[model samples]
Target: MIILCEGKHDYEFIKELISKINVKCDVKDQGPRDKDFIIGHVVDGKRLSYVPIIIEGGKDRLDGNVRLLISKLRSVHGSSTWVLILRDSDSNDADSAFDKLRRDIVSLINNPSKFLLYKPSMDCGQGIRVGSFVYYDCDLKYMDGVVHFRFIFVVPSLEVFLRNYEYVNDDSRLHYAIDKALSDPGIVMQ
Candidate 1:
């Protein structure tokens, strides 16, 4: 299932989950910009993509859009599609929002469990206050049967993850190679 979110931070965070947990899943960082316009398409025999964004000021962020997306899934895919909205559960209307979403989308889905909205953030921080785990937070932790261990390696924040982890850090060479680049003036000048 392609885990879609609002922005890049979420994308990086999800990537961290995939890497840290080794879930072997594809997560498409479909920004809010591309979500509303997306309707439905059966990419392969297994994948079904739909655009379901229902926040504030969003074009397709309503009951109608939920129903529409589900309808498209049912008609085009001819099977149940998992449209999991991993949205932020914050502010006053958080749980209420999910309730409204479930109430609207339930009728359209073959299985209600297939459609869901969950907050994957740590400690359940809400509204705009999202305490998302950085790649550093994930580090690398393996299991040992029933118990667990930690080898806390500081992996930096979301921006650092994008830059260092994914090699999207053309902006800060100093961060990319602070010590070595600093040691060589030419590298800094370059």
Candidate 2:
């Protein structure tokens, strides 16, 4: 599983969450502002860090980064990899951000190979939305299963993932945020 984050801070936040959950996975630092960071990112036998250094862009480039990364991953890993994109909504409300992201994903996968199918939906009850892009092929040699492409929006910013604790300060050390979030009793409830 590959988790792509918008910036260094976002990557740090997800890395902290993964540690809290005791999961082993690569959460990539796609730079401070989303850009073409992972363009030549090699994923098979090489290390994840083999990706080229991309030029960081403005705050509005997250969508473009997501699009490019998804396309690159599809071309390289085919249907065997699952990509989870975590992006901050920034100024947009949760609903609006989700809608725009879903649209962008749909547009990117528009008229995909005849063997692939996709669905876009939101579960209002859980405040989660999903876009499933599935590729089906029986004879492929390298990658031949279903690949799930997910876009998860953190409303306002990644800080929302943490609960307010006496020790938690957004501007302080990142460890404090991680510790406070991990220590929160409600962390596992989600």
Candidate 3:
């Protein structure tokens, strides 16, 4: 599984969330451009690895980054990879944000016929809203086999999401959120 998220804050939040779940993982700083997060856990005594890539350039670069990452993964892992894209909806509505992302992916792969678009369902808690869309058996051009794509959109941005959980304040500083999560592990459950 490969997780693609926007910015360092998203990466940190995910890293902290995985830690809160007691999942053992290794994170490597791939320098200022991006971070390589390899989340490993033992299941049935077997270890599994999930790689997460952070796109510091934000949403505008998502399509290009997705193409680049998928191309690289195809060479090593072949078509047997699951991609999860995490982005903030920002000012856009959930549906609009999802549509824009869907369009971007469709354009990226140039396989609209094999792309199955589904309306993302919204989940809300304490004024915090998020949505997700899953594309199963999606075909990527130049890749031999099918791939699965999942897009998760956090409404009004991840900062708001963290704020609702009391993990960050109005400013939503990276250290502030990390400190809150470190202090209250139960925040993950909420």
Predicted model with the maximum TM-score: 2
As a whole number from 0 to 100, the lDDT of residue 185 in candidate 2 is 62
Put down candidate 2 lDDT per residue, 1-190, tens digits, no spaces: 5555566666666667766665554444545333333333344423453222232343356667655555555444543544556667774366676666666655765646521644222122224432211111111122323445555666566565443443344456666866776676655423
Please list the C-alpha lDDT of all candidates, in the order they appear: 0.33, 0.49, 0.51
Q: What is the TM-score of each candidate against the true structure?
A: 0.38, 0.60, 0.58
Is 1 or 2 the stronger prediction by lDDT? 2
Question: What is candidate 1's lDDT per residue for 45-146, written digit by digit as tens?
Answer: 343332232232331343354345444333222332334333443333444554454444434443445434321111111223223221111111111111
Q: Pick the candidate with the highest lDDT.
A: 3
Off by over 4 Å in 1: 23-26, 31-44, 47-65, 76-80, 92-94, 106-190
RMSD in Å for all candidates: 13.7, 7.6, 8.2
* lDDT (Cα, tens digit) per residue for candidate 3, span 1-190: 5567777777776677666665666643233244222221211122244444554457767656665554343332233445666677776576676666556654544544433342122222222332322222343433243345566666678777566446545544665766574566443332
Clashes of each: 2, 0, 0
